[model samples]
Target: MAITKIVELVGESKDNWRDAAANAVKEANKTIDEITGVEILNLTADVKDGEIIEYKANVQVAFPVREQRK
Candidate 1:
């Protein structure tokens, strides 16, 4: 049998929402293995002087469950 798990993550970037989403996946890739997919939940940004100062992405990251060996 195979199993997968999902975790929510928020990523921030000064560039854009797309970069913010990519950042989320990049961060997850650091600690997570065999990342199967990603679902973008929400996109928001911080505004300053009527300009976007930062982008934030809410995402669901999915990865497979594996047995640990010691």
Candidate 2:
């Protein structure tokens, strides 16, 4: 049997939403494995001095569930 798991992660980038999403996946991959896909849930931006400084992205990462063995 195969199981799946989903997790929400937030990533920010000075570039764009795409980079932010990619950053999320890359960061998650540092600790997770078998990453199937990433879904962008929401997008926002931070402004400083009347200019956009950073882009924020909310992402959902899905991967295969890993079971522990005894």
Candidate 3:
């Protein structure tokens, strides 16, 4: 049997929401392998002077758990 795990990640981008989500995936890919998918949990932003200054993404990353059978 195969098992998987889910972890939450927060990433930010100054450009757009897409980049923010991509950033989260990119960072997770660095240390995680077999990344099955990503789910956008929430979206948020930082405001300053009555304007959206940055974009933020809350995502759930999924990856398979690798273990040797004993």
Per TM-score, the best of the predicted structures is 3
Query: TM-score of every model?
Result: 0.90, 0.91, 0.93
Error of 1 at 21 (Å): 0.5
lDDT of 1: 0.95
Per-residue lDDT over 35-65 for candidate 3, one digit per residue giving the tens place of the 0 to 100 score: 9999999999999999999999999999988
Candidate 2 matches the true fold with a TM-score of 0.91
The lowest-lDDT stretch of 10 consecutive residues in candidate 2 is 61-70
The order of the candidates by TM-score, greatest first, is 3, 2, 1
- lDDT per residue (tens digit) for residues 1-70 in model 2: 7788999999999999999999999999999999999899999999999999999999999999878747
What is the Cα-based lDDT of residue 29 in candidate 2? 99
| Per-residue lDDT of model 1, residues 17-63, tens digit only | 99999999999999999999999999999999999999999999999
| lDDT of predicted model 2 | 0.95
Q: How far is candidate 1 from the true structure (C-alpha RMSD, Å)?
A: 1.7
Q: What range of 10 consecutive residues in model 3 has the weakest lDDT sum?
A: 61-70
